[model samples]
Target: MSESTKRWGLLRHHDFRQLIVAESISHLGSQITILALPLVAVAVLHAPPFQVALLMTFQYLAFLVVGLPAGALVDRMRRRRVLVAADLGRAVLLGSIPLAWALDWLSMPQLYVVVLLSGVLTVFFDVAYQSYLPHLVREEDLVEGNAKLEAVQNVAMIGGPAVGGLLVRLVGAPIAVLLDALSFLGSALFVGRIRSVEQAAPRPERTRIGQEIMQGLRFVLANPVLRAIALSTAWLNFFSAILESMILLLLARTLGLSAGVIGLLLSLIGLGALAGALSARRVTDRFGQRRMIWVSIVVTAPFGLLLPFAREGWLLWAAMIGWAVTYFGGTVYNIAQVSLRQALTPPNLLGRMNATMRFMVWGTLPLGSLVGGVLGQYLGVRPAMLVGAIGYLFGFVPVVLSPLRRTAPAPVGEVADDLPGSEQPVRK
Candidate 1:
């Protein structure tokens, strides 16, 4: 397919549209839960700051535990089936939360279980979803598809939090979570409606799971571009977790902001991300993808430094401005890097590549949340945020030192000396 033929009209693609719709609804629901779940922990269960952070930890813990195996498993199944199962599973688990609350039996441990189960399902859904995309559109269309999907997601995120806040104030956090459950159902329906035939990979002969998993690990670590992306992304996520673990608590506890105000603030952060998503294609086209990778972080990450200085009154607006800027930079970086990863990786290894990246990148989040929560308890909120801000400044170092800085499209398939061979051996 040529560039001109691939230009625009993605929504005209039936399966791609279904995917976009499904993912858009799911993103909205996830954002609502992101706000509502923490509120439930803090308000109803009366969880301490550490426990609240632990809730965040549970949400990413599955990435560390099941991430590698899940990749190998996803490689063996229909990707859409995995997505549907994940959505339905999350619906059932999240729906249980509202029921427990109604029965007046909701406990901190149960909430922990809900988040952990949801997290596990989410890992599968995410890995499968990314792998499935190439099957839906041309390689040239990946950037546009991702950009449009990300833009819609950001729009949903913008409204979802405000709606969640209103729902929390009116019906309560438990019921707000119920809305998310229904959204997952809606997503499942849309996904299942797709008419596109997904051709499953031929079943490989028996092989050791560890060896298969190592193939993925070797591919990632061997490729210089992927290695740098993994390192830089992991570093960024660690600091991002540290910064985010305290945002709501700081706004509510220290600044004495209400739920509605906090939700609005969160929505404002999405506005920045939306802007970045809207501009992603244009920016990358103008600056070149390679330069945009590091440039995005360097230009906007510094805004995070303004957060620790935020105070009540007019200064609250300043805090939000800082958050918006950081959000913008992060979104642009995500869109560009994700598209690059997809383009570089071969189809057979897509599931493992995505999972391995998530394992390395998202795996750091749990520890970072714990550390931030503990540090906030000891060092105070502003100081903890200051430390996170300083960490963000260094996230660009790995990319700056790598081939991604100089090349238009970084070279793929180059295995390092200390690792397995570059070619992934067929299991059979």
Candidate 2:
């Protein structure tokens, strides 16, 4: 199929439009709820700073612990159904927060459980959704489709936080969470209406659960490109996590920015990401997705470095704008990388492959935060930001050192050394 033909087919498809709309609503809800949940932990529950950090720790633990398993389940089940069920589950779990608050039962412990449940459901939705993508659009438009989804999400990320900040300020944090829960319900309704039949992957012969887990691990390990991307992203997430815990504190005490101000700036980062996503495919088509991936990774590499330079007034404004550009570029890199991966990976192993990759990608976040917390305590937030930035920038090292920089697309399962000798081999 010609590139022009692929592009036209994707643009003409009605199903993609419906999927994008439902996904946009869901992403917007996610953006708002993520912001609201932390506020509930801090302002309403009166959580100590450290304990507030723990909330994210518990929430992301599923990404580390159960990501692979969840991927396996997604592969074995109906992908679209899993996505709808996950959204509905999140709706119910998040709705409980406000109900508990109303009944005077919304303890900090209860918040923890809700956070855990939300994280678990998110893992399922994300892995399943990624696996489901090939079925929704034609082969050629995968990058465009993913790019559009990222664009919507980037817009939502900006809008959601900005709205959340206002909503939290107007109506307490618990109620802010209810808004998110409602959004999930909205997503569920639209997603349920979509009528695509996601054909299932043929399940391999039964083996011990451990073997299946190892199989996923080995596949990624054997694939250099996948491994490099997984580690690069995971480490970036880890280094960024360092600043994540300390940023609110730094802005609150050191930089003296108000919550609303900080939230708005954060929205700028998301807006920038949306811009990146909107342009990513065009950039990739013109420059090659592989090259764009490296450029975006390298350009946005200093997300942590911008923190120390932030100051009151114009200085902070400059810093936020810089950070926003980097954030946007990073989104483009992800769009390119994930789309490239999707295009290259075989349909049968897509679920386990996505799960394996994400387990590595998201697992590094909390560990990075823990290290950041200790460094922030000892070295101060500014110095820690500098340290993390230097580390974060190294995400480029893998691409810089590897063949990925010059690689061109091949048919699925034949992309250089980016995959296992054969899919589903057992790893140590």
Candidate 3:
């Protein structure tokens, strides 16, 4: 078989195909919510810049609250069950928004509560989803699997926003959210039909949840490469959150762009990300994974500075181009780093390791959103975005300075035993 065929072979597996379908549907819905949820607050409710930012804060706060514990819980449960349940729960939560709106009872508090609860479910779903993939594909195929998944997500983003924007304009934002709710039901159906059985890891005779959580934490922190990747990713997420919390506000309020136009502009990020996902394997093959990780960020992130200058006419076009390039770099960086993390981890610790890593990386999102809200409310939207755009340039520093620069990518089916501070043997 050709190398290309080998890479694409995972699509032939029945269970993996189901996962792809589920992810495709789920991601398309999520892309709609990504645009519509904030628009609900900003357009429908007349939320101030600070309050609109709080929507993001509420959505991500669950990662910090339950991220580590969810990892331990997932390690003890069936990951597939966790995934299906999370999807169903999200469906119910999101479906409530339109119901409340139809009753003339929709309020900011209800919106906050819905996003917060759904985010909790998301934390579990994401942890299980990442941990579950290894069971369905070969070790060598991890990068291809992750890249395909990322590509599906970006593809959804490319179309979802435009559709969502039109829906928001015509049917209203609350009604647009109902479509997301229905999509989750379809995702749950696909996930439930997956036939592959997960082989449970052996449990210790006497184990504490805290100890398991700590083990995952130690594994990440002790490894120089994991440590640096976590730090760099966290930094990137922090500033990116700030930028996202305000970008809609800038477009809708400052530029006075229509919902349809805002959606089209945002689609550029998805477009660039799709290009990056399609290119990641080739880029890694040519440059090597280590170089690809840092270089992707360093080269493309600087373009984010152009975002602050976005105005009517040519500047808007320049800003959108820069936005797309930045997402392109981020997509490439994520695929390379995530594949490395999955390759380096042992099977027994996969859930916990992913949880710990997410806790560290995604935990910054809420804090950044809160800060952005304050900055936008007090310092002004454009200036706040400038702060975030500037911070993007420095996100690569941790990875560039770490030992990851010197090490080769981990080989398939084997941990990088030669690396300093590799994971310790799991305690029984």
- Top model number, lDDT: 3
Candidate 1: tens digits of C-alpha lDDT, residues 18-110: 999998898898888898999998888878777888888899999999999888788778899999999999999999999999999999999
Sort the candidates on lDDT, descending order.
3, 1, 2
For candidate 2, the TM-score is 0.90
Residue lDDT tens for model 2, 302-361: 654766678887878777777788788788889988997787677656777789888888
Listed in order, each prediction's TM-score against the native is 0.94, 0.90, 0.95
Judging by lDDT, tell me the better candidate of 1 and 2.
Answer: 1
The segments of candidate 2 whose C-alpha lies over 4 angstroms from its true place after superposition are 1-12, 203-208, 253-256, 377-379, 414-428
By TM-score, how accurate is candidate 3? 0.95
Taking the tens digit of each residue's C-alpha lDDT, what string does model 3 give over 1-428?
99886766778788989999999999999899888988989888999999999999999999999999999899889999999999999999999999998998999999999999999999999999998888788778888889999999999989999999999999999999999999999999999999987766755454788887887887788788889999999999999989889999999999999989988998888999999999998999899888889999999999999998899999998998898999999999999999899878876677888999999999999999999999999999998999999998899999999998987644422443432223334321
Q: Flag regions of model 3 displaced more than 4 Å.
A: 2-8, 409-428
Supply the global lDDT for candidate 3: 0.89
lDDT of model 1 at position 151: 91
Candidate 2, residue 147: Cα displacement in angstroms equals 0.4
Q: Which ten residues in a row have the lowest lDDT in candidate 1?
A: 419-428
Model 3: how far is 264 from its true place, Å?
0.8
